[model samples]
Target: MEQDLLPKLKETSVLIMDNATFHKGKRLQELIRCAGHYIVWLPKYSPDLNPIEKMWSRVKMIRNKFRVKDIDKLFKDYCNDLFGI
Candidate 1:
């Protein structure tokens, strides 16, 4: 999975990733080094400081209104709800 993600990420200038075990792997390190892109990792156990975490929390609250059957609708409505229409 990381290998597949590497090519797309290479062209990007900056990426923020949470401090997780899987992302901390040596293969990922090599990928980053080869890509020559600056990577910033958030501190571990600090979801409160991450904006995406707050957004997801809001989505879960609003998602109770609708039955989710697939990824596309769920993501779309969740984003709309979070942004308040």
Candidate 2:
């Protein structure tokens, strides 16, 4: 995130993220602050406020619908089918 996403963002941006352990790291927070952006963590257990959760739910739903035996193969197929990867 520091190497990629942080550099692409405009200055003084507000980053809204969930309370993931990795996101709470001192280094990550310092990096964000140093980059002239702010981090706002979503409330615990508030998946509804996190838009990515809905996308994850959709991905899981699609994966379950396929029910393939091989996970690696299923992931490849899932990406191809969904994203034309």
Candidate 3:
């Protein structure tokens, strides 16, 4: 993933990352600095502040509504419902 992202550094600007310990690695920090972008870290223990969490909750609700036999179909249905919500 890092290799894939390295080439896009020129086009990248600010990086928004959650308060995850793994994302705070030295190598990651170096990479972010080398890309010449500011790293905006979100507050810890604040899922309500993250818009993606809302979409995920909606997806879960939609997935539970249907009796999907295949994992791929369930994922597709969840994404569709999320977008609809």
lDDT-wise, the better of 1 and 3 is 3
TM-score of each: 0.63, 0.75, 0.63
lDDT per prediction?
Answer: 0.75, 0.87, 0.78
Candidate 3 lDDT over residue span 1-85, tens digit each: 2688666777667877877788889889888777776788889989887788887787677677997878798888886775752
Error of 2 at 53 (Å): 0.4
Q: Give candidate 2's TM-score.
A: 0.75
Which pairs in model 3 have colliding backbones?
A: none
Give the number of the best model, judged by TM-score: 2
For candidate 1, give the lDDT of residue 48. 79
- In angstroms, how far off is 42's CA in candidate 2? 0.7
Ranked by TM-score, the better of candidates 1 and 2 is 2
lDDT of 3 at 61: 79
Worst 10 residues of 3 by lDDT: 76-85
Clashing pairs in 2: none
**Runs of candidate 1 exceeding 4 Å displacement:** 1-12, 83-85
Candidate 3 wrongly placed segments (more than 4 Å): 67-71, 83-85
lDDT of 2 by residue, 6-64 (tens): 88996679999899899899999999999999889899999999999987887677678
